[model samples]
Target: MFEQAYGRLVCFADGQREIIAMQWKQGATCAVHDHGATASGRVHLVVGALVEERFSFDGQRLCHTTTLHHVAPCTIEVPPGLIHRMTASPDATLTLSIHHYEPCIASMRIYDPEGRRTVIVPDDCGAWIPEDAAAIVAIEPWSAP
Candidate 1:
């Protein structure tokens, strides 16, 4: 959802769940999208702020219906079938989020209202970091299973 987003999959559980730390540069965003029927997740803001916009699909078109503004130290529950997009707060310099996904995040579906096909979510997890963070050392080559 970002032009140059970065992520590090910090944790994995049985190939069915994952914890990803994602960073968004200014003006970065994902297009309107859904997490798939079998997917559910949560986003915890760790730095800066963000603005989320939810949309509704009527088979013919997508309509914007809701907007949520969040700051650091907040949590957002992401239910399956939610069509939404997010961007770093325009006034903010950058944003960071810790994301928890059930059944993995590869199940994400980017919407295409003008066509029949949806974009397959890529497995790119961005750069790897190694450091003692909160008493846990990060692993290398972190990517979606």
Candidate 2:
């Protein structure tokens, strides 16, 4: 188990399949990120609610696509190569969810549209950039649809 700025993570499996239980605080938002190249996953909302912001990457920049609201007792399919960020709903003090990933995510790409930078981080680091990561400025600015 690990404690992150946004919440706590308890990893159940890390072999061919990865299962992680996460507890997020109200209003806590994860960095925009994508699953590893070939990895796909599902998020099972166990408690509270979440808001997901989905994005699409053009050849040059990342563009906002849609926003989804998920309540407890629901599941969200995360397709391969999908880029998104999740925020804990303010209506709940804490949100809990289980994330299942196949072929376990080895690394993730974090996009910082405002900073105009991107960083690749290990799965253990979640969507947030680690202190040791070196961000690379994007050649083109991000956009919203």
Candidate 3:
């Protein structure tokens, strides 16, 4: 039941900061993919200590345990060109606050478990926008296409 809200983080180009209430259901998981330019150099935290997994796919199964980053409110500085994926364990149940420095475009992609993939557009996902974005449009997830 972790919900999103506005935070203290400030976005220079996009304005203020906003939080997204993502309910990583008991068994629900986010697709594996490196962050976009927005999160390229951002540092994030594992506020709720939820269980998850990180993995790599270079024609082989390379998975890693989701390390417990006890820094509840720590920042994560993600470098560019980092390929990774994650999945929520059955115990995950918290809100995710992703602080970005600018507007997200279509550079993000989802690594599908079914072997199908597609580009993830910010307007479509509505996860990278501000708290009060206008004229928004949702892009279809690669799950279908």
The TM-scores, one per candidate, come to: 0.73, 0.84, 0.48
Model 2, runs deviating above 4 Å? 1-5, 134-145
- The stretch of ten residues in a row with the least summed lDDT in candidate 1 is 136-145
Superposition error at 143 for model 2 (Å): 13
| Top candidate when judged by lDDT against the true structure | 2
What would the per-residue lDDT of candidate 3 be over residues 5-102, giving only the tens digit for each residue? 22233333343223333333444434455555454445354544333345554543434535443234656544564545433344445634454532
lDDT (CA) per prediction:
0.66, 0.77, 0.40
User: Which candidate would rank higher by TM-score, 2 or 3?
Assistant: 2
After superposition, candidate 3 runs with Cα above 4 Å error? 1-27, 37-39, 57-71, 87-93, 101-105, 116-145
Q: Which 10 consecutive residues of model 2 have the lowest summed lDDT?
A: 133-142
| Ranked candidates, highest lDDT first | 2, 1, 3
Q: What digit string (tens of lDDT, one per residue) describes model 1 on residues 1-114?
A: 224434455665557887888777776675666765676889999988988999986655677999999999999999878888888776778688998878675545556444
Clashes of 2: 0
What's the TM for model 3? 0.48
TM-score computed on alpha carbons, candidate 1: 0.73
- Which of the two, 1 or 3, has more lDDT? 1
Q: What lDDT does candidate 2 reach at residue 41?
A: 91
